[model samples]
Target: MNRKNGITVCIIAIIAVVLIYAQSGISFGDPVYQDMDQYFLLNGQVQTGGNNICTDVVFDFRAFDTLGEATVLFTAVMGVIVIFRRLMKGEEYEAE
Candidate 1:
């Protein structure tokens, strides 16, 4: 097969696999452990002293995880900016 047909076949195969996986009995957004959910619902406010349980869980219980996510996002944005800046440096552009 030619390159374009080969690429199209690969993409269709990937999509078919994804559709099959989605149809499987895997559950999304379902908590595996009920005890942890119960503990969070019961003592989340008392331990964190936060009115919003979701906010408390993110900012307090999972602070390090949240920080890591933010760091990764910031690094990705910076890397993209650096790459674009280098690419644009060779071209003439008007600055406002």
Candidate 2:
């Protein structure tokens, strides 16, 4: 198919998927305070021993998950920088 038709099909598919996802009601992240209980059970308390359950869950039990999430954010930023750099380099090469 031509470029325009391919782009139109992709956009339609993306919109359909997004609509389905929105209707599914599945949530990401801490939905409620009770969600912390599972984390507490899996990971033992240390510095979070006497702290509130939610705090313990957030700072202690899910520490690595949080760290990985932060790493992902950092990676995305770096990726954006690399992408922009490549674009700029291409422009410079074209200019030269």
Evaluate all candidate structures by whole-model CA lDDT and list the values in order: 0.87, 0.73
lDDT string, candidate 1, 1-96, tens digits: 899999999999999999998767668777567897788889999999998998988999889989999999999997897678757857854454
Clashing residue pairs in candidate 2 (N, C-alpha, C atoms within 3 angstroms): none
Model 2: per-residue Cα lDDT over 27-89, one tens digit each: 676455665556565554554574476766656667788889899999999789768776674
Q: CA shift at 39, candidate 1, in angstroms?
A: 0.7
- TM-score for each candidate, following the candidate numbering: 0.56, 0.39
Every model's Cα RMSD, please?
A: 6.0, 9.5
For model 1, the stretches where C-alpha displacement exceeds 4 angstroms are 1-32, 88-96
Query: Which whole-number lDDT from 0 to 100 does residue 43 have in model 2?
Result: 55
